[model samples]
Target: MFIKSFRPFAQSLRAPAAIILVATLAGCSTFSGFFGGSAKKPQPAELQPVVALVPARQVWSARIGEVTFPLQGNISGETLVVASNDGTVAALDTRTGRDRWRTSIGAPIAAGVGSDGKVAAVVTRANEVVALDNGREIWRQKLAAQAFTSPFVAGGRVFVLAADRSVNAFDGQTGKKLWAQQRPSEPLVLRQGGVMLAVGDTLVVGLAGRLTGLNPLNGSIRWEAPIASPRGVNDVERLVDLVGHVGRNGNTVCARAFQANIGCVDAQRGALLWTKPANAAQGVDSDERYVFGAEADGRVLALRRADGEPVWSTDLLRYRSLTSPLVVGRSIAIGDSAGLIHLLSREDGSPLNRLTTDGTSIAASPLLAGSTLIAVTRAGGVYGFAPE
Candidate 1:
């Protein structure tokens, strides 16, 4: 379900004829399989053993609303901010999962619900950035083009990636344009989950399976490292894009590219630490010792964060498209297309627990709040679970 979201973005660009045909093939469910596409609706794994590595229970579950377009929920300090495509944004308490505030801005939200404790912002489908101050609309500014990624809020500035392959920065307080930076883009790009992470004073952006560190103050390129380069002759075989979440632990940042590889880099010096030939549909997450990722074939892998060596892997849920892994307590939690959340032991990758939410595939990755795990499904079901 998540991989299918990239089709619209590729369609917006003036791609080559071959690339356009492949993108259209990706959109058609029947034709996708002949091209070796893994985006099909796969059957979930049979009932597996629950090891009880950590006792957990669902704290609360609620039907927030419908999200016509896929968008990930954001985790603030004590609030969980989520938005629907129809422009309904809500802030929920982390512990109790109670609604703090929610309001409709009367516009179709295309980009985000990005917040920095005080202010929250979202991009409308009409190419406008809307800022909200404590649930009240503050200001709206027009953008150069439509944005599919989330608004990145940091250091009194809001950063977004437009459909034209440009990054625009605006003042968080007043919606004034700060600086805009453009990069050489492919004819096709992923429409969703292209993230920008703020590391100290620098900004790390994932563009076309390459990592570039930009000076947020002036939008200048500091360093570049390629996660995967264009290789195949046709554009479809060469469609390596940085997808899913980009995570950081201490000074190292890690990201995953579709049909490419997963790699970690030093956020300070932009040094490539390690790159592994892993074809994963989603990104990777880590604790202190190990990094965890979910593959398109329903295999979960664990690698040493220090050296990027394989630690363990499990294929207990093969063929079920899984969400990115989220580590909570001693278990690695991942949601599947069947709406089941599987918790595995962090030590040996053993099945710990399983959860279900609304019987719909989870579009957004799970968010960790304190010790609890908050996940939202495609059907707009929000669930909060914690150790018992």
Candidate 2:
């Protein structure tokens, strides 16, 4: 027997009986009765011995409140900005891990930590977008719907992609609305973070399974490239939201459609390069040569950047919930649910070294700043590592 669990977007809203029934049937599957009673989850693959090929050591550590939502660590120059679910947000020096600034939003945050050095932005659970400057609250404006994706702050403006499939931009200094672009609503949306970033003068975002580019000056569509089209007979199977932490080399951007496909796009031309079947829910990272991501079963894979072809795949971490991969130097770093950071060779998927954090799930994808590698745990443990 097999059982699959699907997380709802918002837990506060209660659906009627009919809607609940339909959602349950669409989101989950079980064959317990057909078997005997229940089925056990597959055991995680045994970890290989670490060889310490990469000489890295934890340099500094810090903390905030425990992170409960999708948190994207924003990097600007030498500073890395992070936020916790309890409304605590802080800026730290990537070199020394010393606090540059620390402040709270005065309300619980749902998603955030987008910064462009001068301005920091976060979306609160109260449906408000909050902007901060040097640890002080500058302005906040109410949003129309919930946003699970971190706000993208750039070009003196803040852009938000909401769960309702709407994109809005606001003045970073005044909280005044600039423009809003709404898309056709879907029956179901993922609770996870979606892709939103800036490439040159274009604003690239993920709406459903399509990578969309818009003019940042005003809410106007520039191009829409499909990574995957919604298929299947039910809403859950048709849910194809693009996840975050995309791979970009110049104008070429690659992303993962939730459990559907992995593909790259030429953002400047608004053209898709290629897409290949990939059953993964996490996003991908890239170097100049390869795109890297972890499958739902915890297999780490690297595909060619020019064309979507598998270069290497490793199942040593299978069944262990893994975060998106981060390409650091010649190695790839990934955090697991057991709070361990695994480093593998970029040439081949071989174990290089392993590091540990407070025994909890990695709250977000690992980030790199200058020469330091940052990983945050669900228990609010922030660790900075550097080459020894």
Candidate 3:
């Protein structure tokens, strides 16, 4: 009776093995790419909410330097060094617009790179890198050709490059020659890493959209890796400012780039482990865990120290070439081009507090000094903003 009435059902499960096998197959249904079409409905895109900018605060205003070619802000010594296409380098007080000293670089200045440690480089149209001390000429070396890159000082070594493809390393204080080398001409023009970085025993050069490692001792090529920097842009001739000692890890030496890029290279081998484009690029300031690149597009990008990855980004362009972004007391504090100061969240781009500079364009980057926001403007303005 059971076999006749439930004949079909009994046959379907002829064996306990077959019953379990069918059940297993049913349980293996996939959510996508076959078995089952999809699970939940697709999520709809959401529009960003309109954000209201907090009011800007004003501090002080003064005309410190004149806008010569847009990207040339080569100020040095207590006097601000302002260069014009007219072959003049003006020295103004760092605090006041008052003139301190001025000299003719002998030719139309192509690059306005200088140092504050009691020296300034005066370049002629012919590519002469001269060492000047306290407004006086110390030593001048006629280069093989003209140079567009700035000078770098580190490990008691001051380095300058000539358009002729020569690299010269000299003693920072005495203006004596340490070593020199020539780079082979490549199809794509090569460039040095940045003027801002002066590490212990290494001098980094950015070339052919790559970072070249050089032994400061012998000026020899130590290693090479591709690190693309902004080549040519109106008002922005360069986008690489080779920043500081990227907390070294093992054989890898980490450093920040002016544009939204950073990398950790084998200090000895010069191999690239990882690279990520930062959302913003301007002046990068950082701590142990992150490196910050300031962007003209009005955003602050934070990258991880281990790998060049974006952790967070904050937009502050509305205020002006906002102050240099700083990592302080768990917050990123910066001043803006409009003379407004701000305290932003370090974890994510969020508004924290505010500071004001009555000055204008504080156009330069902020001095992220140990919880202090110091900035200057072309009008010879200075400010000291701190936490209460």
Candidate 4:
């Protein structure tokens, strides 16, 4: 049930029946596809040889657990914490891929492994927020709705977005209820990943294509910025949930609206800085100078962070289902459906190196740990690589 999708608007418009079928199936399985059940699986793109400008090789890999859906793994200090659908949560050494500790809470996990070194939080399929510390259960709190996004931990508080579109905060130490913010829920939303960004003292969440900044202490609205405006006659055409990860550095926070655009805003004031038309399903990643993203057509692009101006774009992996790009050292890394990690030049988007994972589709962004880049696959294989 791992969902990684980038359906075009044109294709969706021609298949209203498909949309209906997906909507019907969404309630039953908690995951849905706009192309319906009859849709064919896309074949992985064949990899052609590219000149390896920089030497890179796999450092270590391990089968951690099963990821039944597109999930997020958090790195706290040197420990990488990950969760599986079957309620398994494990803390692994980021450098050696060795297990630190593992535990199974005995319920289907719905989201998260958000940690702030001391505490780890995750949602259960039974609609509960479970908090753990040092591989032991600390506390659990029931939620009114299921969560589709990872719980975010910051400033001794745990924040999560419920499926009903409410933002709930809990004490990072005791799982005590803090404050909750509610928003109008969209009729149809992506059942997989959603955006939650912590900037300074504000908790920024993407709700129905709008970015709302909240005072994490009291759950009050600091400001609201619209990332995308809904359009067209049907709800299908107006589906613009902010998908995947949100990028933040200093006061600049950027996010991508599914099938729409990528935009940045001032985290301090919630003012729109700049935006560009981006037909991207995933979100963007940023370094000091550039914001990187992948388009639905499998094009990887880099834009200047200051003005949202396009710097470079490469269609070399077109139709390959590229993951969100992760900026590593001198190269940018992006995973594909074929389990290959393509490292491209950050200067020009040229292919630099290629590495393979466990032959399962990579649904999460590659994470940088010291000099090692860690990529997780759909079947829950963790692979670490470093430039040789």
Candidate 5:
């Protein structure tokens, strides 16, 4: 199921509850690589990631039923919630990879993600928020515009941002719009205690560049600061993905300037705390102490937590791609363009081990739950590794 995205995610996606199961392993050749001679070429990465491969590695592999869509993962109860490009929500027994149930709701299949104990997704054609509970639709609320930004489940309220620049807060149980805010620019991201979006009237929250701090309630201006926009060029025209993240650093709501840099702002006052040159076109990830992502030349740099300063840097890829490092315990688990997951020692960027997966990465993120390290390939393979 991996040559390319089964469906296109453009503008406001309308899902239709589609389901597709890919049994294609022809591309598995890419992993085995007849692409080049196995002379043990040391075309090194800044750090080499190591994984302990015992029979323990292959915990289990399940051929889940027809699942079409950019994949999203979540852990609920003992079930793992996965949404498919095909408009269906499914629940799988996390331990044994057994099917719990499958519920099909007519909606544009979305890469919608899961939050809390629930999965936030939108129906294909209806453009409504549908809350799913173990393969059952708890509630569905129709919206004025198409919904994007996979339903964000925070503070027990299912917060969803629409492509039309509206923040709709719904009753987590029964997809009802409890509060709605409209702003100018699209509300592309969500943070725990930070601003809501980039531009808009009633909800144009978020302070980047020089402004800082925002009120999540009304999208009001709170404070300001002098933040230097990351020094770089925007190659993707006006294509900016405002995927904001909450740094484990408490009240800091961190955002990235696509193809530019990273901005850490005061989540409370909209005050620009700091801006560090990142040049990541897609997005970034951090653990309060350091932020890691590609710089101008596809070199992954780790910057300090307090002030944005370089601590370590390494080669990530040739042209530049999107998988960000999933910082686990003492190792940095990063995915490459070739469906290879690497682990690096955090102290000094040293390669540890590598693991192979089914497809390449387009939207792969490091998954950290308890001691399990999870990596999801874009074509839809979830890998669980022990963070040695």
Candidate 6:
């Protein structure tokens, strides 16, 4: 049944024709088998029983709505702000699992729940950027194109990275359009979230395969650094959009170019430190010493922070759909399609412990707030785990 449905897609890729826009593509996972050079879906490896090496327990759990979109949870101090595809947005206390506030945008959200504690922002499917102050609708502004990446709310402004390869900034309090910057559109873009964040006074964004640093006050290009370049025969093969949830330590920011390479940049200097080939769809996490990410084939890997050199690799979760990893103190916490969160030693990719949530795929990358590790599932179940 799967093969029959994908036959036309495979045939289309072989033909020398213009491919459909990225919005037409199902998702990052939809390109998995085809882009991984396999038409057959590989069976996930059976899990072996794990003896808990690190003590942890589920502290609490909550639900919003089934998260069907590319959702990224925003952590501000002790509050974890999240959104559902149905437009429900809420900020939950990480320590107590209590709602600080919850509200709906009255339209399905394409991406969002970016918050800076005071103001929360989300983009609706109708191409509108909505801002909420303490769960009350403040203002909304229309966008020129669809946005899959969450609106970055920081430094008293909301920034949106639209799929059309344009970046816009708005006044957080008034919704007034401040500035707009556009880049040449690419033939294809990932349906998933793209990178956009603040480093000091600079707004760093992923414009196609390049990490561009822009001045927030006025949308001027401060510097640009390429993590990957287009190099394949077709648009599908050449897609190199940068995924979100990058690793940042002080002035250095590391990110993964969709199925292309993983590299770090000196955001302060707007210089590319190094890039190494990495066929991963998700983003990466880092601590002081290592950068961690999972490949599409479900291999978890660690690379040195200074240089993109492989430190260790583990295939224990091979073929299982895995979310981007989160670095806890001594362990790396990552979730899989089966709703199981695996904690591995940061020193080596050895299993430290395993945790479980509602039996559904993890919707977003695992997040850490204070000492609590939060995992949101596709079923909209938000589970919080803490060291016991």
> Listing every candidate in turn, what is its Cα RMSD in Å to the true structure after a full C-alpha superposition?
7.2, 8.5, 23.3, 7.2, 11.0, 9.4
How far off is residue 107 in model 6, in Å?
A: 0.5
lDDT of 4: 0.76
Estimate TM-scores for all models.
0.88, 0.90, 0.60, 0.89, 0.70, 0.91
Tens digit of per-residue lDDT, candidate 6, span 27-61: 42223224335478899989898888998999999
- Best-matching candidate per TM-score: 6
Question: Any runs in candidate 6 off by more than 4 Å, and if so which?
Answer: 1-38
Q: lDDT at 297 for candidate 6?
A: 87
lDDT of 1 by residue, 312-384 (tens): 9988977777777777778878887788888888897889888878888776777788887888876788899
Model 2 lDDT per residue over 195-244, tens place: 88877778888998999999887879999999999999976667778888
Candidate 1 worst ten-residue window by lDDT: 8-17
Count of clashing pairs, candidate 6: 0
Error of 4 at 36 (Å): 5.0
lDDT of 4 at 251: 80
- Model 3 CA deviation exceeding 4 Å by range: 1-63, 69-109, 122-126, 155-157, 162-166, 171-178, 184-196, 228-261, 266-271, 278-283, 316-329, 333-342, 353-363, 368-372, 378-388
The parts of candidate 2 lying over 4 Å away from their true place are: 1-37
Instruction: Report model 4's TM-score to 2 decimal places.
Output: 0.89
lDDT of 3 by residue, 232-303 (tens): 652133333343213343445554454445666665567886766543233345566776655544666677
Q: How big is the positional error of residue 345 in model 6, measured in Å on the Cα after superposition?
A: 0.7
Model 1 / residue 279 / CA error / Å: 1.1
lDDT for each candidate structure: 0.73, 0.82, 0.49, 0.76, 0.50, 0.83
Model 3: worst 10 consecutive residues (lDDT sum): 9-18
Ranking by TM-score: 6, 2, 4, 1, 5, 3
What TM-score number comes out for model 5? 0.70
